[model samples]
Structures are given as C-alpha cells and as structure tokens.
Target chain A: MKNYSNLNLMNFLTPGPSQLYFTVEDHIKKALKENICAISHRSKAFQQIVVHTISQIRQLMNIPEDYYIVFTASATEIWERIIQNLSIENSYHLVNGSFSKKFYDFSVSLKRKASKYEVALGQGFELADLPIPEQVELLCLTQNETSSGVSMPLSDIYELRKKFPNAIIAVDMVSSAPYPDLDFSQIDTAFFSVQKCFGLPAGLGVWIFNERCVEKSLALEKAGISTGTYHSISSLIKNIKNNETPETPNMLGIYLLGKVCEDMNRRTIQAIRTEISYKAGLMYYALRESKNFEIFVKEEKFRSKTVIVADVLQTPASTLINHLKEHQITVGSGYGAGKDKQIRIANFPTHSKETFELLADLLIKA
Target chain B: MKNYSNLNLMNFLTPGPSQLYFTVEDHIKKALKENICAISHRSKAFQQIVVHTISQIRQLMNIPEDYYIVFTASATEIWERIIQNLSIENSYHLVNGSFSKKFYDFSVSLKRKASKYEVALGQGFELADLPIPEQVELLCLTQNETSSGVSMPLSDIYELRKKFPNAIIAVDMVSSAPYPDLDFSQIDTAFFSVQKCFGLPAGLGVWIFNERCVEKSLALEKAGISTGTYHSISSLIKNIKNNETPETPNMLGIYLLGKVCEDMNRRTIQAIRTEISYKAGLMYYALRESKNFEIFVKEEKFRSKTVIVADVLQTPASTLINHLKEHQITVGSGYGAGKDKQIRIANFPTHSKETFELLADLLIKA
Candidate 1:
C-alpha cells in the first residue's frame, strides 16, 4: 500500500471539492479499466453501478428504507428541483449562509410565495423564533451552512419537523454528510454533493427524498405544473426503478462514490465521526490559542465541525492561508463578503489525523 | 509510453460515452496529483484551467471570435436552457431522432408554442421541406443526431440561417462536436457534451452561443420571465467573464477535455478529421460488403461519420454485440425501438485505424 500521508502531494483543506480519499485514485483507475465511463446508461452494467452505489450510500448513511436516493448534476440543481417539485405556492426558508439564501432565491425566482427567517452571518437558526406558516408547503433548512460554518443541531431539525408536520422539510447538507447522524425519518428530503464529505470528485449530487416528496411532485404534475424536464422527482423515480438516470450522468463519479462509500462502510461511520470530532477539536483549540485568529461562529454549539471558519483578528486571513500554501497545503478563503476577514478549513474524512496536526501546528504558530 | 493499442482493454464502439483518448489516463493522473479536483472554483488556478480549456476548444472547433463557451451538466440540460433563455413563445424543431425529439418535448413542457418538422428515425430533414413559421422565435436542429446516426449537412444549417434570419438557430452536436466542420457564425447557438467526440468522461456539456442568445436571455429576464436559476445564460456569461462557472462543475472532466483538445490541436484538426473520414469509410464499406449487416441510413449525405448505424439482416444485433464482447470489444445495440434489429458503432477520433481494421475483419467475417 502506498503511504498517502508521506506522498509529495498538496493537501487540500478547502470545504468540498476538498482532498479526495486515498482510495479514489485506485477506484478511478478501476473504472477506466472496466470501461465504466463508456457504458450506456440504459445498459444492465450501468444499471448495476447505479444500484450498487445507492445501496452502498444507504448502508453508509443508514438511510431510511422509505427514502429514495436520486442523482443530480449538483446540489445547486437540487435546490431548483425541490422548489419546482415539492413547493406548491408557498415555501419557508431558514437562511444562515449563502447556499441557504440561494435556495430561497430559487423559490422566489420560480414565482412562488417564498418567505425566509434570516439570521446574521455565522449564526444558526433558533427554533423558537422560526415563523413557519402552516400554509407553507415546503420548509428549507441548511443542516450545515458551507459558507459561514454555522451548523443547525439535530435537535433543531427534529423540533422543526414537529412544528411543521404537514410541510415537507428539505435539508441542505452539502458540506456535511455521512457525518451528521440525523434521523432521516424526521426530514422529508435532504441533499449533498459527493465532492464534500464523500471525498470524491465533483459532478454528482445525491438527493434523498421520501414518498411524500414524490407524491407532491406527482400532484404538481397532475395540476399541469412543470416540475422539471429530465430531473424531476417523477422522472427520476421512473429511472431509479430501473437503476438508471434520466440522462447520461457522471458514470465514473457514481462508480467511485459507490467504492468510496463501501470503503467507508468497512471503516464504520461511528469511527469516522469520532475521528472528525477529534480533528475539529484539535483545530479549534489551536485557533483559540492563536493570537491572530478566532473561531468565526460566536456560539460554540453552532460552530460546524466539518467546515471550520475562523475570523482573522490581528492579521489578514490570507497571511495564514499563504503560510499553509507554502507548506503545500491549500485552504479556502471566506466566501462572498467575508472573503478577506475569514478563512475556511475542511475537516473531511479524507483528511488524515497527521495532516490536521501539521495544519494545527502552523495555525497555532501563525 | 503506454501501448494503448496493445493493452488488454475492451475497445468501445458505442456512440458515447465512447472510447477515451489514449492521453486521458495520464491527464487524469496529473489532475489527481495536482489536486485539481479539490481547488475552489473561484480560485485563480481554477480560472486558469477554465480559460485554457475554452481556448483549446475554440482552437479545435474553429469557434467564432464572437461565440462564448459555457459549461452545463449535460447536453440534455442545454436543450432546456436554450428554450428558457432564447425562445419567447414559438420554437420550431427538426426531429430526426430520439435526442432531437426530446428537445421539442422540453420546449412543449415549458409551455412554449412549440412545433416540429418530424421525419422518420433514420432520415434527415430537407431544408426546402421544412415548414418554419415566420413567427417562430427559435429553430432547434440536431447537427448529428446520436440516436439514429442521421446528420444534417452544414449547407442545410447555413440555408436555414439565411431563410429564418429572425429566428435563433440552436444546433445539437452532442455526438459530433470537435469533429463537425461547422461555420459558427451561421448558427446562433450550439451545444455538445464532452463524453462524445471530445473523448472525455460525461457530466460536462459545452454550450457555444453568440451575443444574440445572451441578449434574448436578458430580455426574457427583464420581462419578468424565469430564464433559469444558477446556470442562466446571464449568470454563466458573468462567470465566463471571470473564467469561472456559476456553480462547482466537473473539474476533472473539464481538465481532461482541455488536455485532450490540446492533444487534438497538436495533432492538427485537419489530420484528425481526415483519419476519421478514412476510418468511417472503412467501417461503412465493411458493413456494406457483409452478408449479415447493412447501412441503416439510406441517404449517403445524411449518414453521420461519427456514429454508424447498421441494420442486422442475417443475425440479431445482439448476436454481433455478444460476439464483439467475447473478443473484448463492445459496440452499441440500436437505440429505442430498433434495439434488437440494428447496431450502432462510433468512429470517434479516439478509435485507432488498426482497431477499426480489426473490427472490420470481424464484421466482414460475421
């Protein structure tokens, strides 16, 4: 086995499209050798890949039996699909970051009666303050805000589900997945891109939705609404029954995802989560001790363990980013308006404990 | 150097995703080592990749100076984007095959006043026979329909441009891009997926459009119409100005496409097209001389050089496919309703002359 730790490769700490799993290179090579990318989506061989991938994902995530896992181009596309299919006229959003805000904007752009309970940057939603109207057909929530690194607790998600029993709850777990130990039965739909916690390449988004979401899409189609063309829930469900996609998908990505998820299953999700928590704790401790940086999220409980966002206090965030880059480590700058003032670091499973220790040392010294 | 020709790899003659270029494996390895998949889409490095790839594509395809190259999830998505952005109400389609027919369906699903000049599966449209209404805002054509291996001659496209000066002409070159000698100025917009002639993996679609398409999208947005979300023409154009995508794309696929195009440019497009014509000629001749198979498209002018469809006369198409599989070669079964009655073979740039000769021997013998 090659020593991934000692390999002369630049380690990426950016949230998503982040460092790939050590096994991904081999998986990709196997895919190429097996001619996976060349197979037709309609072929039984391609269908086997899709079926195996969905099964592996279910095993890894402990996905509910009632939920269906469908593929999309990206999590961004899923936001639009959700708005088109599940939302009738009214939808409610809990916006704490850029990605969550974009989902709300999608609903509005579709000429839906969309309303949101907005919070400041680096803050998670307060369940008591959420004003989800009974008439709202869908409630959009960001389980982990990728931009600001603010994560809503599982308790908050469960609480929202109780409060809005009739409304479909859609969760955006783009930057945090296979780690958030959530009860899938509590949420009607959830989505995450494989480029994130799955430690795979970009291009494939995994959307998990229950029967309620499917029934809603059928209802909208019956009402003569254009849910979507190829990627609508009804179309996806029809294809998924045959273990295929509505269009030619990233077959290589899907194949790699299955292999990676299978690898993850072998390692066990509990063990992976434990390692993630430890790495997050070490990094957080290092940031707190550093004179130049502090944790961006004020509330300790709200801080995302997956994506760590830090506010540069005494020095520019670029200085520390450049310092890490000099060591052949790549981290992310803050998103949107916080571009210069903060830096984001991903604590995904692909990132080893040794790599985190090296980054933590540099961050503390800086 | 790896002897790709002698390798024990199964040669795929499916339309697409067909055989990958010999250089793809090494390019993918380089991308993994360089951590291309992990980089931020907004980063300067990622922007460089995007710009370089677009430049290479322009060089290879002889795209016009005024044309802008934007990326989408797939060519299927591009059909919807063209309808949403460029068409106001009335759109006309030339439906030669399944893929072309789907574009018409997308427009109709969007509630556009869509009309089509339909033809038989293995037939191409006659320019004089087309009933293009004067009020039609868009004319959708398939330069080379992948489903039935029917191609519209460049002269037809140019004539359509002259006949319908007011209508936006959007061409689907999904299975024939980078190989089709198209005059970019004659068509307002054209789109293709990289999995086909580009000899890369799926998940990235290239949409080439001129300023007229952009202006139409802007006008639609101004009129309170929803062009799209995230990947609207306006959003893609804005990102293209910065050499970035509106969302996280298939970075690995894009990187591989650039390297392949660069490889193609180094070999010279004229030389590649010459080789393609030669290989296609050899395959078609073998099919014509064979006792078991015959050319599906009756008209020589309409037959696609890239995808060759053959009618099985003496044996079921599946028997030939199974025979090829036994020899570690894979050719596609006919698409849709003609599944068992016909076979499709792709004569893409990645397919070597030696490989084609070997397949030709089998085809002639069978």
Candidate 2:
C-alpha cells in the first residue's frame, strides 16, 4: 500500500544494485552485437574473454599474482563456499549488520562451531578485548556494513589480521571493494558482487583468494570433507587456469563486469576513489547541516563512505524517500527493524558528483 | 590452435548458449531503459517480475501447481544440489554422456554410495538392464544429454520412475525443455539452464521439483545433514513462495527469461514444439543424405530433437566446422574425445526455419 508510481523509471541510490556503471549499457549493447551472450564457456573465444576479464580485474585491483580471482553467482554463495572450503571445526565473525551475521549463521547451518562478536544496528565493532575464540579456522569480517552504513576501517582490519595470524581472514567487501586498498598479505580471501562498486548487473561475484585459502580448501577436500562440487576451490582453480569456470557461468555478466572494470582501469582506480570520497563527504555534510536528521553511525571514523545512513527526526524516513523518489532518485529506507527511521544512500563510483550535489539539495529541502 | 577468427559475430547453432530468443535484444533494451537492471531484489517490482516470470514459465512449460520451480546459478550447480539436498546415503544415475556422468560423480564427490547404469557415448539407456542398487535414495537422469545429443525418451523416464518408486527422480533437461512435453506427475524433479531451449543468456538454472523432493530435503535439513543454505530446497521454497529468491539472484537474467517465456507463450508452446520436431527432422535428413557425414546416435528413438550431432568421415569434423563457420553458422565440435570426429548443431526454438534450411544447404555442401 505504499503509494509510489514510476518505480521503474527512478534512478536507484540504494546500497547494492544501484545505478549501473555509465558504460554498462554500451558494453551490453556491444556484447549483444558481438554475440558474446551466445559463446560457449569452453570455446576459445570465451576463454579469451575470460583471460581478458581476469587480467583487467587483476590490474585494476592491484591483486597479487598468487591470488586467484574466481567468479560465483553472488556474495552470499561466497559466504557458504568460504565456510565449506576453509573451515571445518570453528569459525568467527565480526557481525555489525545482517550481512555479516549471515556468514556466522552459514557456519552454524553447516554444522560447524560458529562464534561471533555482534554489535547492535548502527554500531561499530571494536577489536580491543574482543572474545575471538582459539583455533578458529576462519574469521569473517564485513569491510562495509550496507545495512547500517557502518564500516570497519582498514587499519582495524590490518590489526585484526596481525592478531589472528593463524586464522584465515576473509573479508566481505560486498558493498565496498576497489574503495578498500586491501593488502592481500593481510587478507586470505575477499569477495564482492558486481552490482555494488563495479556497477554492473547482478549475478556475478568475484572471489579474490590467496594461495593460503586454496591450500586449506585442498586439505579439507582431501580429508573427505565435502567442500561441494563444481565450485569447490580446487575445481574453480583447475578450470580458471584454463580460462574457464567449473560450470557454464554468467557469460554476459562476466563480459559486462570485465568491460566495466576495464573502463574503471582506464579512469584509474585512484580517480574513482577520489570521486567516491568526495561524494560521500557531500552526503555527510548535508546530513550534518540538516537540523532534523542525525547521522546513524556515532563515530565519524566508522561511517561508511560507500553506504551512508542518516536518522531522521521530524519527517518520517519514508517521507524523505518519497520526496527524493519524486525527483527520480530512490534512496533506501532503513534496513531491518529501523526501516521507518533511517534513510540509506549509496555513494558508488557510478554515482556522479553532480548528481550527488543535486541529491544533497533535495535532501536539504526535505 | 583452432584457427578461428571473428568468433564474436558468428551465429551459434551449438547447444547451450546458442542463438538467443529473437526478442532478447528488445527485452534487454527495455530493461536497461526502464532501469530494470538497477532495481533491488527486495523491491516489490522485482518480486512482481519473479512472479510474472515464474507464472509465465509454469504456463508455458505446463508445470503443475503442486511442483515448485526455483532458480540456481547453473545446471551444474543443480547437479550438485540434487545430490546434496535429496540424497543421504545412496544415489543412482543413468549416465549416457559426459553431463550425465558428472551427476554421478557429484554423488561420489559428496561422500555418498553412488552407482550408475552407464552407457557408451552416443548411446541411450535401456531400463531392462539397469543394475539399480537397493535402498537408493535418489535417481539422476539426463533427459537430453547436451554433450552427446542423446535423449532419454519420456516413456523411458516414466518407466524408470515406476521402477524406482521409492527413490526421488531428478532429470537434467539442460538443453531441451519447453520442447519436451514432460509429465510432472511421472517425475519428481527436473532442471534446465535458460541458455538452452529457453534462449536466454547463461547463468540462470530453473529447477522444478515436487513435494516429495521437498520432504526429503526438509527431513535431511532438520536432521542436520546440511542440505545447503540460501538455496536449500526448503529455503528456495520458502523465498519463492513470497515471489523472491533466497539470495540476490540474476535479476536481469530472470527478467529476460520471463519476457522470452512470455513470447513463447504468445507463440504457443505447441507451435514451438511442432517447429522443433520439424527442424530436427530436417537436420536428421540432411545428415542422412550427406555422403561424408553420419548420424552419431545409432538408434532412431535415441536421437535428440534438440542437439543434433553428426560423425564426419573422409573430411575431418574440424573441416566441416570451419566450413559452417565460413557461412557464419557456428556448430559445436564433439564433446570429450570425439571432438575432432563429430560436429553438433543445435535445433532450438530461437533458431529460425529459414536459417535451418540455409544451414542444411551449407552442411550438405560441406
């Protein structure tokens, strides 16, 4: 009964699956014209596309040579795979929002000993005096909490990596990837869906994992523990070396992702990061000046640059959402139970600086 | 090296990821223009798209009301899931080709007691001779083997179902669905990738199963057997009931699949089926009349009405493949060891009648 028409025409500013990368439409059109969608995963032409894409992502992300970049259906799949492949006895999670909590739930569901240090919504996690369990095989951390607009700073992540040297540190960069200049030496694994910072269509998830993660997966798999098939680390690794996937993957999605990544590489990752930070600054500044609205995350350092949330006072969050929607800009209502109180806006690379200024003006009026 | 160029522009007549349904480009354009690619999976619009697509598929494929249709990343994933969710100790497979054999391999990979009734490549299974083990919890059958173009006729599938009444039956209709008049009451589970007969892009797998399969999955999950999360049969059933997926699915793929299904429904599934059978007839006739090529499948009943494979003699299969490539008609080289000896041409709904005739002429000349 939410009275909203013209939803299909609205430009999405919601956290994930927001506005597509500016070059996406053109890439898709070119793909169709080139019959890229019709190519077989086993075909030489497809293998070349795979090579080109992986190379583009590696260069753009500055990934180490030993790290393997793999494709999965979604970041959610990566959560399940990480647990299945890397952990056997126990796993730990830094749960600040729903997404991080789900990784913990996955371990529990898979009959593993799962532990977590959970924070309330709109709160941040502190590593000091945190109860991280002993012999915890995998530690899951969310770099950016899309639901609450809270992020764990890279320095804290690096510190945790130092503390848990024995544990495989996996980062969920679902909403913030290229924005985070992650040190592969500190992180064992990381994953992100294309809909987020890459601004491609949903369906593809890029899993960046180092040799350490692969070795653990292989060891577990060798011991007759089921790490699943077709997408097992060994299987994915075996196929990806030949420029193939263990299964017939999302050919069009992969092509679009590569093209978008190529476009980003040409623009230089530094330029993209600069735009994202600039846009995020504008959003936070507007929120600070709005007398009726308060920033959701209490600490300035914990506020996410990619997913920005604000708590509204006099006007309902839905009212602000609708006000923006009228201008063909659709912001997110609060996630989970706080839906009516907070508005979330994504400051993705696809979101231009000029558009952010206009959105800021509209938010101030609201 | 295969010495092929301009591959991206060639029209694919190979099996999966073949020519897209004629309306695909239009649907994609509309999707991009309407901001369909940007919508959140949680949005009501997306759920409606799911509802419409599922309904369209149900109507077009004649899926029964009691059966549930779910999405997976690929048919290979479905093969893994069918083994994971349904089977506990033992599973049976009727393997006639590489795809079918892989399903059996999955059961073995997952630490199950797996047995199979395997036939040679380009061969079909006979029920009378199958050494089906007792206490088998699940049965895997590939309705249409894309690798070898060998089809298990519906009558045989029904007979197998009758023989294995206690076991859950799973059919891999990866390359030939909508064209097959499947009797849902006779089978427990069936799956296909949209890239195949539905003529969408790669990445989306449509899995259809009955209440019996659901019961097994739920019982296994309840007993802490780890049927999987997010896409477990129970989770899929739960989310799909609300017209949603357990994870952020391929929204673009699902949207385009729905539009393609809608188009097929408008043309009528009956007409589509009639056209497929007719075109398949033309392909077989062309193979029979060709002096240098022979139909790979020995038995007439075993021949596929979708993927058509031919054994090239005198001239190498690669030569015929290149000849077709010259005419911009891309056919699949044989699967596995037969790659240089056989050629495969797909007969899908997306392939036009006139194009088939032209292909037939060119193939004859080759």
Candidate 3:
C-alpha cells in the first residue's frame, strides 16, 4: 500500500478537473520511466494494467463483480452512447443543471424522443412531482450535477428504479463519482470522468454497466440501430474480456487512474468519503454563513456534498475568484448565465481536510 | 531551445505509441511541477495552453493557417466524426489494411453508403484501378497504413484529389504526420494520434480539417442530420475559437503535445523528416537483406517510411521478437492474423539513426 494525503499549495475548487490526485504525480513518473504508455494496448503488460485498474476501481467503489467497466474519451461521450445503445423510442431525463440537461439534449440530438422534467437550476427532482413519460426505454439521472452543484439524494435517485422499472437507469456522475456510494443494482449503468472526484486529469471516462445495458445494446444492434462504433458497449465488452479496447485508449490516463485508485483503496474509499463529508460540511457552512455569499441550492438535501454552489452577494463572482487567487486558491465561477453571480466550490477527495479548513476560513471573511 | 539526442536503451519500435519523444519526459516533469494538468480547461491559462499547442502544431506541421485543428481521443474517433459530419451520401475509401478498412467500416457503422476499392494487403492503389463510386461526398485515404506497413505515396494520395475534385478528401495520417509534408490544399481533412509520429502518449488525437470539411459539416447540420454532439465539427470549431472544448479534454496530453511539438519545431520537421527517411531506409535495407525475413510490401513506393513490416520466413515472429528483446530492443509483432508470420518495426522521428543502425545490425542475424 502507498501513502496518501500529501499537502499541496494552490487549492483548486473547480467542479471537474479540480486537482490532481496526491499520488498521481508519482504514478506518472513511474509510468514514464517504465515506458508504460509506449506498450501496445494488446500486450499482456497492457492487459495487466487494464485488469488491475478495473479491479481496483471495482473494489474501491464497490462495483458489483458482474458489472462491466469500459473506457471512453469523456463522460460526454457516454451520454451519446447510452442514448444510442440503450434507448430506442424515448429517453427520460431528470434534468436539474447543465450537465444533466446535456444528457437529455444528446438523446434529442441522436433523434430519440427525449423527454425531460427540468427543474430550476440548483434543484433536485422530487419523485412525487416527476411525470412518467410514455415508452421511455432509458431513464437518465445526474446524481451530482456539476454545473449547478445540485445533487439528487441517493434515496431519491434509487427510488426512481421502482417508478421506471422497465427503463434502463443511466447515472451521470461526471462531478461526483466513486464518492456517490451508488447502488449499482438500482442503477443499470453509470459513467464518470477522472478529473472530478478522482482528482485525475481530464479524458478517460469510466463507463460501468450491468448485463441489462449490454442486453439492450445487443438488442439495439439486432434491430439495426447504430449503437456507435469503436467504443460501443458491445465492442467495449468484447475487447475488455481480453483487457483491451476496440481502439487504443488513454493509456497514460488509465495508468494514473489505476495508481490513484490503488492509493485511494490504500487509504480506503470509506475514509476518503468520510473526509469528504467533513470538508463538504465545513465549506457549505462557510458559504451559508458568509455575508458575501449564500448557498445556491436552497434545499439542504439538494445541495451536492461534492460541489457546493454559492450565490455571490453584493459582488461579482470574479471578485471572490480573484480574492481566492491571491491566496493561491482557485474556485470556479457560476456556470453559463449565472457566471457573474455564482461561485462553485468543489470538495473532492484530493482536497484535504486541513486545506478545506483554510478555504472555509478564507470564504468566511471574503 | 532544449537539447535532444539523448541515448536510451530498451528501444520500442511499435508502429503507434512507440517510444516517447526524447524531450517528452522533461516536458512531463515540468508539467507535473507546474500543476499543468490541474489547471481548469476554461481558465485563461488553459486557453493559452490550447492556443499555444494548436499554434505549435500548425507551424510544426506547416498546416495551413485556414485549417482548423481539433483534438479527439484517438484517430478512430475522427473516422466516425468524418462520416457523421462530412459524408451524407457516399464515402469512398482506399482500403488496403486494417486501419484503412476500419475507416470504411466506421462509415458503414454510421449507416453511410460506404464504397471501397480495397487492394491486396501490403499493396497501394493505382489511380487507374479505382472504380469511382457515384455520389461520393467523401474520399478517404490512409497516407500510412500501420497494419501492413504500406503507405500511399503523397503523389498518389494527392492525385486522388484531382480525380475526385468535388469530394471532401479525409486522409488518415494516424501513423504518419508532420513526417508526410502533406499538401493541405489537396486534403480537406487529416488526423493523427500523438502516440505515432508525434511520439507523445496514446490519448490525444489531432484532427486537422480545412474550411471545406467544416462547410460540409454545417450544411449537414443545417439539413437536420445528426452530426453527433459534444465534439461535433460545428461545436469543436465554436469551442476552439474560445480556446475551449465542448467537454474537458486531455489536458496533460495537450500540454505534452505542445511541448513535444515545440521541441520538434526547434529541431525543425524538415530535419526530422530527413532522419525518418534515412532511418526508414536502413530498416527496410536490413529487412530486405535478412535471410530470416523479407519486406512485407513488395512495391518500394508503397512501403511506409515510418513503419517497416517484414515477413518472418523460418522462425515464428515471437522467436525473432524474443531475439530483439534479448538485446533490450522491442519490436511489434505483426497485426491481426499475421501476428506470428510478420514483425513490424516503427521508424518514427523519435527513433534515432544511431539506434536504427544498431537494430539493423541485430536484425541481420535475427
């Protein structure tokens, strides 16, 4: 087992692509020295890396043994894949923020009859208010919406399983993954990029799905539906059995992800998750109690424990962003139309409890 | 400029994802220290990195100023993108090997009317032999086929543009770029992965397309056709103009690519191309003279300058592969079904003339 919790300067609290995993730099050095990236994707050595990485991920995240893990360029790619492979006639989206809305948009873009129950930004979907859409074969959910820092509570997210029993549930954990403690049995498929909670670089999306998604994907192909090429679910499953991808994937990213996952497993994800709770609590409390900022998500349970969104008061978001920059801290400003008004702060595993305490102190007075 | 020509043992002569560029290690070290990977893709700092990287790529490759350089996960993604965006009716492919055939396959998978004039393995197409397809909107060509170590000579590749004057020419330079000295005027679009000639890691793919391809993409989008989403041609162009991608991309890959390109530019691509020619000659000469092996491609003109494939005559490919491994040298086994029958040797810019000379001497006995 490797060590963890190396303190670094310059706190990056952006939602996704926030900070490098503490051990990632060390892992990268090892990879480069061994020419790990130069190895053929088909090589036995590459296969070992793929197998070890997936195994660590599964063990760390408690992903079921039956779930198949695949790699794609980004979580954004998964949006298209889910729509193309799992859904035929219609897809339902519980949209709250931009990232969730994009999943719905992708279904529509793929020419599927995509129906979305969109709430106000920074709000979560309530099971009681959600309308059951007709003939929806895929139910899309963003467990953690990065753009608005809204989170659908796990209970609410899993409760949809009963309502949308016939549909494939695809969860987007672009901002918060491995941290969500998701019930994989309840969620048929889920996807995430490394940059968010994993604290790895962008690129290298991890797409995990059970047999149901694969059966649906195979059915789609049988019906002459284009489930995509290269990194399609079918091809990914076929290639992954040999510990390879249909295309040469993000080898270095995978290498680092494996090492990072291993390191997280060393500290234990449970420990990391517990630390995340404390850090998220401190940051959210600071923002909620601040004179200069107010919590963006009004509902207590709706706010994401990973990404905390705050409405900047009596100042542009840039002021707070710059204020933190002076302290060598970086926090993301509001996304899209709320760019000048909201400040989104990430409380990822890469963020230390001590560092979060410092950031919370800074936020309290800023 | 930083110096190069460092001596390193344990040579990797695989086609793509060969040895990392000599300077890549230093650049990666610097990137890790500077927290380059941790930077936000939307930050001005990240925008500068993207701009600088794209600018360096354009200048190093002498790509036209009008050409739009976009990044994808792999060259495989570009094939699907080209079919989805540029070809609405028919895509004519000049297929000889696995990689080129996959490009045609992607068109078929996308449900495009893909026509191909496939020559024998290790053979290049003659202009007279091609049966021109009707209503072809895209003409696809692989300048260098990594699978069979065959290259369609630039003259022959450019000749197709004159023959199919109206169709968008999308060239696959997956294993050959910057070394090709490609005439941008004759090719509407071309793509290559960094792991090949660029000698970076495997994740980042550089997709270069001229205004014509973008115009076709826009026309297709205007016609309400699904041109895909996220990294769509239209979205890529729009996002790139703002120095952003529609999604958070391979930040570390882009950073390393920029530094590596800068190193290549400092050394000058002309010098690299000259070295590639010389090293390629030495490799081909070694293979041709060897009693144990024979050149895979019979035609001299069709032989790739970057990847040299040779038939294993007496011994299994592994025997010769193991023989080289004994000397701390690694070479690629033949691709696909030919794995035991052939050995492919990479002759990228990173492969030094001195190293190739040593390998050539070793191959004389193997």
* Best of the candidates, TM-score: 2
lDDT string for model 1 (A229-307, tens) is 8888988999999888889998898889999999999999999999999999999999999897879999998999999
Q: Candidates sorted by TM-score, descending order?
A: 2, 1, 3
Per-model TM values vs. the true structure: 0.97, 0.98, 0.96
lDDT of 2 by residue, B1-366 (tens): 123335556778989889888899998998887788788898888888888898999999899998998898998899888988999888988888899999999998888899988889999987788888756789888999988999989999999877878989898899989889999899899999999888888999999999999999988987879888888898899999998898889999999989999999999999999999999999899888879889999999999999999889965688778777888788988989888999888999989998899988876777
Clashing residue pairs found in predicted model 3: none
In candidate 3, residue B1 scores what lDDT? 6
How many pairs of residues collide in each model? Answer: 0, 0, 0
Q: Which model is ahead, 2 or 3, in terms of TM-score?
A: 2
Q: Residue B95 CA error for candidate 2 (Å)?
A: 0.8
Q: Residue A234 in model 2: shift from native, Å?
A: 0.2
The true-versus-predicted C-alpha distance at residue A118 of model 1, in Å, is 1.0
2 versus 3: better DockQ goes to:
2
